[model samples]
Target: MKLTVTSSLLALALISSSADIGVHANTPFIIEKSPVDITLFVMSRCPDAIKCESTFSQVFQAEGLPEINPTLSYIGSIDETETSKTELDLSTTSTTTTTTVVTKVNCKHGPLECAGNTHQLCFREFFPDYKVWVPFVTTMNSWQPRRIGESAYAREVAERVLGLRQRRVRRFLSLEEEDAEEKKKELEVLLEKVDECSEGQRGFELLVKSVQNTLDHGVGTSCTVFIDNKKRCVVDGGVWRECPGGSTVADFVRSIKEAAGKVFRISW
Candidate 1:
């Protein structure tokens, strides 16, 4: 279906059990997730993506954040040798839980996206406590599609404002710049991407393929909203065609809550 956005927001609070931030692929953790997949794939510079990210921020702000189970892994692997996690005290009241399984948390916007995705991965690996990754991603997503700056520019902005550490941003940038004999290898060292050896050689070719695998399902079209793989449609031209009965912008959120019921939140 053609995903179109008018003005409503699909707020998603992903309260991942924070992962260690500094783990590398060579020394990666044995990450495992449930069979469910409630992933969101968008170009790093798309305005639609911003709507989803920022709108979720508004939702989280209004309803509050979800508390991570701590035992379950959000970004990193749950098979780590050490047991280290920040404790989050949450008032168990409202929760909006979707079918979030082993979803790929990635970006499709080019070099800026690559860096953004990896930076988020690193944050989950190193600094998973703050959970401001959504804000940071949304900050970069605000960039216009036609006009975008260099990777260094994104890195500087993230560090100066988004609070990403200088070194971590540099590492992601370095990964984005890696190449060998007319082949880009930046995706190889991305700490977050799942390592897939498709079509031989692990490079941008493979990473792109991995990212596309999920996006092919049609979430890449616009700020596509999915609650547990069920597409939520916002009324366009007075037609609510995506769901059983769609609603307008004001009723959009209400429909989600009414449909999803009891959404749980988790910051960082």
Candidate 2:
């Protein structure tokens, strides 16, 4: 598929109202720290990607003021194939409880007649013990698809669907951990900034921008902040704002914090 790529600049503004209070280089806003060793893959053209990016940017811009440990490094241009492969591997292996059966049958009758034959005179089973194994195989096969699908969905939900929010929460928590006082102050400032940026903006345009910006620079696919080992998020551009069930950046962020808190024991 042809991907439409767009570029927008994220100005990490460290604006000071007065000259007496000079913005210090070591004050943390301007210095770009390595993000939390995470990698994110996103298409520049995708809406969900954009949403994820903006959320992280907002979070970083908000939390990255006074410096914090677990720096979030934002890498550019993810290899889609590699990301997909990694995701697939993670999905396939992260599952539990899989069963498979091997069956061996001996018959003197023709292969076509085996199905029609009901009497034991035409066929004999070499491994009578195999019958006991049949249930195990059947159970395994029955649950295999569910296990695989759940793992895949889990990864998708964690990485692609809920990634931006997770990264934001993680970064926020990291900031809190590194310096609670600093994080609190920065969060206040960030919230003010968000209020200002969102002022006079309303409705769908605001929603789109929120999602788009998040993906482009903040939390999702196109984010600059890295969280774990892989990109903490993914953008399903095809589904972005295409339905009412689609969530806003704020909503997603809230949900992410809640979910991550449950899973990773990190509070936002």
Q: Which candidate ranks first by lDDT, i.e. highest?
A: 1
> lDDT tens digits, residues 27-87, model 1?
6445333222234444445555556555544543434223221110111111113333444
lDDT of 2 by residue, 42-108 (tens): 3222233345544444443342232222222222222112111222246556644444443322212
lDDT for residue 228 in candidate 2, whole number 0-100: 39
Q: Measured by TM-score, how close is model 2 to the native structure?
A: 0.20
Worst 10 residues of 1 by lDDT: 69-78
Instruction: State the displacement of the C-alpha of residue 76, model 2, in Å, after optimal TM-score superposition.
Output: 12
Q: Which candidate gets the maximum TM-score versus the true structure? A: 1
Note each model's CA RMSD in angstroms: 23.6, 28.9
Model 1, which residues run further than 4 Å from truth? 1-38, 64-130, 143-149, 161-213, 216-218, 234-268
The C-alpha stretches of model 2 lying farther than 4 A from their native spots are 1-39, 43-51, 59-234, 237-246, 263-268
Score candidate 1 by TM-score against the native: 0.41
With candidate 1 superimposed using the best TM-score fit, by how many Å does residue 175's alpha carbon deviate from the native?
33
